[model samples]
Target chain A: MEDQKPTSILVLDDEPIVCKRLKSALEKRGYEVEIFFRSSDAFKRITERNFDIVITDLKMEGLDGMAFLTEVKKRSPATEVIVITGFATMETAKESFQKGVFDFLAKPFKLGEIQDAVERAEKKIKGNIS
Target chain B: MRILVALDTNRYSQYVVNEVAKLAMNTWADVTLLGVESRKPASNGTQPPRNLPIVRKLQEFREEFLGYFKDESVSPYAIKRWGYELVDRGKGLLEEMCVCKGMKDFRVRIRFGQPTKQILTEAVEEQSDLIVVGCSKGEQCTWEQDRNAPEKIVKAAPCSVLVVKEEKKPTKIVCCLDHDSVSQESLELINQMVTLHQTDLALVGLTESEHLREEVDQKMKQILQYYTAQKIKAWVSVVDVSLLDKFIADTAEKGLIALWMGHKSLIGKFFSQDRVGKLVRSAQSSVLILR
Candidate 1:
């Protein structure tokens, strides 16, 4: 029998404060969390390994969130992606869902919102495995 | 940021609370839920009874407020250890209820007196950045207890005031200001509004003359750059100060209208105090008076 591995999460936001806060909050919840301030850098890392969950901001300097999430889904269909944005619009939300995003959150969201979203995503992953 | 929420025993207050909750969730603002229990002429200077109906209503408001953050797993503010301690202050017995989760300050204060005066006093004492209050929908925004409470608060509050006409979300936000002196906090508040409603933003610049129009254009550009960088669906347009009133009247019917009425604001100079109050009363949509 093998010991269960902890869930892995990757967080990307251009704002360092957002990344830093989410990193600290998510890590305290006993998950393996990695953060990136640049979507391009996050893209590079995602290419290197697959993560169970990816949390991203929709608007960024390069490789915008939509494109990144599209790639994530293409590479690993089972991975859950949550989209957080300061600029939330109906079209973007519809598009994100169309890209198979697991959840969408607006900026200034309470830490609890992201926590709840991740927990739900975790349950789905576990359910699929079992 | 400090937000003073004026709640009464009405469904409108719930709309106000829900709106504020959406904002506070994002900003982590120090939130003060204020309820005023109007005193009878005979009971002017006495301690309010513990079982006053307003006290019970305030408790319900507190619970409805905290309910928005119940799913919050990161802070102790989410804990259900709610307690409020009332204190006497000679002039008006104020019940100060403290609910803390480390850094955030979420408290309830029950004031005794006129609703408008109590809300204004609390805004001054707390030095609140914004006051959130709701009014019934119609050509005249009314409160159940006081017919003119919302109008009075919007007119007299020392800080910014948000008059929520109803709980309905606006399709867009029209932010009107003449200069770039808009504070970062105001911009952040607009950001929170846009996010909560998932709406578009329209920046309207006001100018009186051709020379000032150029400056207004520059300022609008700077503001637009800020919102565009944030990735908000925002656009800009210039409106003459002469036509500002008409612009506001027309736009208010379409979406939420925010006016920068800070001391440095030229828009503040253009809109008289009564006009500001009237606008809040007559506007078909919610209004945010940014100070």
Candidate 2:
């Protein structure tokens, strides 16, 4: 496991507990993970570093998920983003797709579901690499 | 069913025509090739060029185009027709074809609209099950600007919308989920679409917390079960942001990627914008963004 190249992921959410939980879960799976509680901070880190996938929450205090997604696309054109929101609506879903989101997830989610999403991301990333 | 392949003589339009024709042939549906002549009226409003001449020329081109299909042994059973009227003429032709073809299951109409409103109205009126549209090639346009056709169609259409890129195929389908309730509906829809298309399915998730990993895994199991019941093959992968691009590049290599529209996570939102947009604009494969 150590010899294998660890896949890296970035998780951005306003909740500290959510970040911590995600970081721990991903690290257990042999992924190098980073967490950010604010969209601005997350954007700063994203600009400075390259990540394979970015998971962000839709609604936040300062910079919402939609605005952050715009910035991420501007900064890293190749990174795949999966959006999670507590407020899910048909309009928001359509808007997210129009904006070109990779996937959409609503809040109060299951851990297993997130794992499936990561599995897909890892497969996609590895496929590109090899 | 009546299938309309509307043409404006653009390269992408030609491609769409070919694809629609192929679909029509396979489905054994009646096909109509209609070309809309968007000629500006004479400055003095002289008898705006007789419809006969324009129709004749368009008919000739249509025959020539269809001739290739005939040579390939896919006769369209009908000749191509054109008219000078814009939406009204197009709609009339469509309705006429529907009745003439004795269509009972489905009817397809393809025409260039003012982009948004006209197309949306036509789609609603026809009660279409699916609308196939071409994305503008080599142009910079925002979703908010100038009646963005693809965006508007996806949002306003009562049914599914497939935004076709030039020479694109729907082969690889990627479902982005957040292990949430909303994603369940999106997953079901993705499963149905992928199965119908006989495409490969990939489930993607982002891991933000250690506690959630088990939950993510359980959800993956459920998805696997769903696909298994449908006799559809699928693979699931979980990655954090660091590995997202590599995942996309890999899955896209096979064909197109289909993503669920509303997954509400920070990463989900990011994927919606940067990753999905990049793929749609430049990825070698086509993308289906489902809402």
Top lDDT: which candidate number?
A: 1
Q: For residues B142-243, what per-residue lDDT tens digits would candidate 1 score against the true structure?
A: 575677788888767766789887777788899887655666557767887787677899998776763455566787788888877776779777788878
What's the TM-score of every candidate structure?
0.61, 0.45
Candidate 2 local lDDT, B1-291, one digit each (tens)? 223333343445556555554443333333444433333344443343444343554465465545545633223343222333323343345223222312112232333335466555664554333455555543432322232445555555554445565665567677665544334435534544553456788777666642235665677787788666545678787666566567666776665566554523245353544455554555444456654
- Give per-residue lDDT, candidate 2, residue B192: 41
- Candidate by candidate, in order, the iRMS in Å equals 8.5, 16.2
TM for candidate 2 is 0.45
For model 1, residues A10-113, the per-residue Cα lDDT tens digits are 99998787888889999999889999988889999989999999999888897999999999999999999998876555467657767888777765445776
**Model 2, runs deviating above 4 Å:** A1-130, B1-8, B22-99, B102-113, B136-148, B155-157, B168-171, B178-199, B206-222, B241-246, B262-279
Please estimate how well model 2 matches the true structure, expressed as its whole-model Cα lDDT: 0.56
Q: TM-score for the second chain in candidate 1?
A: 0.79
